[model samples]
Target: MKMYLISDNVDTKTGMRLAGVEGVVVHEMEEIRNALDEALKDRDIGIILITEKLGKLIADKIKDIKLNYHTPLIVEIPDRHGTGRTPDSITKYVREAIGLKI
Candidate 1:
């Protein structure tokens, strides 16, 4: 299984390329959808890494894919600009999920 990336910028794509990951850079919603479709169709691709900016553009679609599919896990990744999440996002998520303060 291989990993594929869908980045929003050339710099992020270039960096991933250096790490031996192949991907496309798309900014528009249609282009992001097409890239995701192509990646999902490939049996060899087991993981799909998409930039957080692009992920926010189609959060509902990403949620649906994650809920329905068993293959090609989709992950939201930070781009060259860094993560959009707050430093305590994970802690908040954990607290929310288990109803416990950590």
Candidate 2:
């Protein structure tokens, strides 16, 4: 299972490359869509890492893809600017998903 990264900046791309994860830096929605399409067509790719900013930019499309496919699992990660998520977002999401406060 190979992991591919879709980065919003050269910084993230370079960092991931140093970690041995190959990636492409793209700044537009069309480019994201194209990269995702290409990645999906690749049977070898089992995971995709996308920057938070670009992930938010294409949230709807990504949601649909996640629901429709089970292979390439798409994961959103923080970029050079760090995560855009609120400090409590994970706790809040966990609470919402299973009705737990912790």
Per-candidate count of clashing residue pairs (backbone under 3 Å): 0, 0
In candidate 2, what are the lDDT values of residues 1-102, reduced to their tens digit?
999999989999999999999989998789999998899999999999999998999999889989999888999999999999999999999999999999
Query: In model 1, which range of ten residues has the least summed lDDT?
Result: 72-81
Q: List the pairs of residues colliding in candidate 2.
A: none
RMSD of each: 0.9, 0.9
Give stretches of model 2 more than 4 Å off: none
Against the hidden reference, what TM-scores do the models get?
Answer: 0.95, 0.94
**TM-score top scorer:** 1
Best by lDDT: 1
**Whole-model Cα lDDT of every candidate shown, in order:** 0.94, 0.93
